[model samples]
Target: MSALTGAAAVAGCGGDDAGGTSSNSPGATSGGAERDCSLKHPVCTAVTSDCVAVHDNQGATTLGLRMAQLTITKPDVLASGYVAGLVTQGLTMNLPQCNLNGTGTFSWLLEFDTTTGKLRTGGAMPTVDPREGYCFANMTAGEFEIAPTEIDAPLTDGAWSGEAETLNVPIFLETSPEPIILPLHQVRLTDAKVSADNNCIGRYNVEGLEWDNACLPGQDGDPPAFINGGKLAAFITLEEVDRVIVDAVKQSLCVVLSGDIVKYGTGADTNTCKRDENDQIVLKGDWCSATNSPATDDCADAYALGGEYAASAVKINGLCPQ
Candidate 1:
């Protein structure tokens, strides 16, 4: 087993891998660079292989959320019109409509209900590997040790809802280095659906993103299936969110709709900030760092975060490494 590790910051994700599959094929995808280091996904197919193995009959099937599709619903809050103006509108009103996907390699683990059951999901990150932390090819099931995340929502035939008090994710915003510990005080995974065969869990779709062709080399012509789709939400601290937006906290806005909040009380809460024409308490300075932790400890609180994901399952089996 390895020590607990976390991936920091999310940028252009990866390159060097253990299996050596994700890099360049040297055929044609490498159009510009000598080896195109783009995120190439594995070919999608309903693998009937039973990967749901409990560590010594421990009553849990471990899984790694190899690919994660994250979303930030409203990035255009600054340009929103009568979308229930955040300034003068009521307290609880629809902010706006826009979806911005969060990029980065997502390394997550889970203990499913049954190897092939439906909607059985609950787990955490690998005890050690943090995406860029291990070569995907060199990973083993043993390496996918469980972390200290707890969620108790069972499989249901109704609306999706599950809760985790505090979930810390190690995101490899950048692959070469370590991971960033993105803290979620209150976390929720909604509308989560598990496939019939359980080997796969998604039907994730994002137009030009992880679509049909993105599922990689097909398996006996299984006619691209987009099954990875779900909503995962949490209240993220500004420090964690800053890592994704590259520390753009000062320019960040938490529209309260009705001028209720005297101060942001969130974001980069600093004394140096002041108000402009609008009563928005404007702050300054980079409150976060991809390579470092938050500037202030008090900033570890949270802001409502909405994330939509289409994740696929990968076994925890550790294999070859370079």
Candidate 2:
């Protein structure tokens, strides 16, 4: 969640000239006493989802700021096609309707803190206070702010189309009136199965893909590491069709989706683990203490979570492939 710095503190639990922590502030917890993880709120155990949900929905709002949404689409995307991951690098912001001005870019880099992919803005815009109906009330003609999120990735690409919307606007009291809403929406390349030729090509490299504990727990040496004690599985396919073979290509590995490792082994001596694609090793999925012993089981479900892999590497096993 973004923070309101300097002097943009008013409606909700915003602070003043003195920088105050949200928890320490008077009204920070005023929103219905901060709902707990009850049957009403329900806990989401998925790791990958936690960050996206927070930043995607309430991020700008938490900081008392708003975000712009970007969408991309392709004109002639075939019915049987898919892009595992697409990155958006450059972006610009403009709000002609609001009679306001500012700048910034949004991208996929924020999805994973460690990724190098990113989008940047050229300048700043005044913060959008939904409380004030996204009003640009505080700033003079020149002052501005920047708001961004990790969910703005281009979901589709292939003769594509795109749009950007700024959530930075104003809001008014119920008695005051209505405000402008910047709804970001897009439909990128749709999902479609590969053709027979493509499917045949996708099948040639099945042996190259395998699950291992590279991204699992106890491997990074740092407990706080993102993949520490985590589980992962990948399915990789290499195919040759139409005289074109997508080599060194990677798609998705299912186990990594849940953001948690699928368990394997007996009641107590069970060994939980995940396969890390980048490092090509099995990582411990179960968390261990300095004193506790490691899991007794040597193998985790290799095909767990429908995990798939599509990568290009020189080594096919402990030794490189000829």
Candidate 3:
């Protein structure tokens, strides 16, 4: 197994110029772009094998990573006539709404679970049961919802441009009287994380300007990342939430960190073995790459899940499932 390594950053959240670009912006989503890469959308079917696993030989450990793009809707926060009157008679109390059309990718691993077929993230943990990470059961099991974590992909090509606007009346415009409008320029992921069987992740970028609300600094704002291809739209729906749970509970693919599962395990520890009844086999010698010491780290703590998988492994079949 080769040691995992890479450089990733979430471009600082600064002024428009300082902030890094997002996926699905104008001129970002072009033909043949990695961001737009995906399999054709099949008809909406019941919980089945929407997942396709590409296998590879490794040591005793079997790691699998699945990627999927999904559509999600954001619940809109509408202020009634009363709230609108407080701001300005005719103006509406507007807030950002998730743009379901935006496409994003989610990823998960497959390992063993004592109760179900496997154990994943996003479940009650021994220490914190209700709090968990992304997990998936067998191929048919749905994905589980864990706290949302940010995937850092550098701002290369295939990026999207967007903005978020909000109304701030920090002080009643005693003199100016007009509620100051705060506009936050931003970039969003065009693809949303739809399900566990279809979680997606990677160096995401975009090609089209999903132009949303345009504003002049204050008063109200554009639909930020939640718009065309932003945050809220990036959430997993209840339909396949359990799959996420299953995937989260499963182990991440070794190929995600070593180009091949065999190398991943060998690099980590040639003697490591996969224990069927015990979940310790895969994560037994888990260590912190930054610290280089065995520590109790969760799947999210692994370097591969942190966008280091690109160099460590070859992206095949849109994901790597060992």
By lDDT, the best candidate is: 1
Candidate 1 lDDT: 0.34
The C-alpha TM-scores of every prediction are 0.43, 0.14, 0.18
Candidate 3: misplaced stretches above 4 Å?
A: 1-143, 146-255, 263-273, 276-279, 282-322
Query: TM-score of the candidate numbered 3?
Result: 0.18
Cα deviation of 169 in candidate 2 (Å)?
16
Please count the clashing residue pairs in each candidate, in the order shown.
28, 45, 81
lDDT: which is higher, 2 or 3?
3
Candidate 1, residue 212: Cα displacement in angstroms equals 13
lDDT of 2 by residue, 52-120 (tens): 011222122111111221121211110011211110111111221111111212211111111222222
**Candidate no. 1 TM-score:** 0.43
The true-versus-predicted C-alpha distance at residue 45 of model 3, in Å, is 39
For model 3, residues 1-322, the per-residue Cα lDDT tens digits are 2122211111121111223233332222346254232222221111122221222212212223322211122111112121111222111101101111211112222222222322121111111110122232112111212221222322222232211111111111222322222111121333322222221223122212133211111122211121122231121111111111111112133222222345323233222223335443342223333342334544222221110111001112211121
For model 2, the stretches where C-alpha displacement exceeds 4 angstroms are 1-18, 22-125, 128-130, 135-322
Error of 1 at 156 (Å): 3.4
lDDT of 1 by residue, 87-133 (tens): 11111101010011122233454444443433223233322322222
